[model samples]
Target: MAPALNVELAAEPRSAARSRRATTEWLASVCGYASSCDIGQDIVLAVNEAVSNGIEHAYADEDGVVTVCGRIEHTAPERRPDGAGPCGAFEVCIEVSDNGRWRPPAADPGHRGRGLMMAEAAVDHLALDKGESGTVVTLRRRLGCPVSAS
Candidate 1:
């Protein structure tokens, strides 16, 4: 993709769905894949969980902004020892961040503490960085086999 996608949203309940929609639409156009594909849907789900966590936990007592960014990176494929030519590949990176202090999850979260777990399970890679100012959740997925065309 030539231009990266970025969106800033108010930390609210509706922002989760908004972020999901934006990610789905942007990724579909950028990757030239159907939005309903497994990889695309998995990425969308991870993004939604991250954004929702930012809105619900990060800014639980204060108003803040959540940012979502998405981009595609071209990678040089691994060269086989058999002297096969290099094949192009791509990796998708999505980051969700909020300008609010991190809050520890409740002791008995019950049905609410699975966001991070679900996010981690959905993507090939997931990371969380919490600092003094805010928290950032990064999700990455490599486009491999079964990537169907749109």
Candidate 2:
């Protein structure tokens, strides 16, 4: 794998599905050693949640950009099987930025406040930044599964 994986997306709420697909492909390719459908689903959900939140809370009806980055851990070659052992866990990071008036609305007892929470639940870590232009959310998840059958 490369040193880092990066993907940038325009502010298109309807295009969230595209972003989701890209993330799925990336995860499958980068972690294509272990087979775990559950883990794959987790990564997909996290990506969907983050992208959805970015569209709803950050961009709303305006325009902006969202960035996704991934970095794989490096392991010793001898420990690796056939010099192709595990690629190690991946730090799947996502950053969403928009140029619209937005705030991560209070986590209320409602549906709108769920995306972030679900996203957080799906990943290992999540960070939020709210400002005048919009909101930026950073999410990370370690993928331990492969794309084969899962």
Candidate number achieving the greatest TM-score relative to the actual structure: 1
Candidate 2: give the clashing pairs. Answer: 34-146
Show where candidate 2 strays beyond 4 Å.
33-36, 74-90, 106-109, 132-134, 145-150
lDDT of 2: 0.64
Per-residue C-alpha lDDT of model 1 across residues 1-150, encoded as one tens digit per residue: 435769999999998889988988887777666545788789889999999999988876788999999887776565445766543367788899998989888899887799999999999899999999899999988765322243
Candidate 2 versus the native: TM-score? 0.69
The ten-residue window of minimal lDDT in model 1 covers 141-150
Instruction: Give the per-residue lDDT digits (tens) of candidate 2, residues 34-134.
Output: 33366667867877787776666675566677666655543332323456667433455666555556663775756556777788898788887878756
In terms of lDDT, model 1 sits at 0.83
Per-residue error (Å), model 1, residue 114:
0.2
TM-score of each: 0.85, 0.69
On lDDT, the candidate that comes out on top is: 1
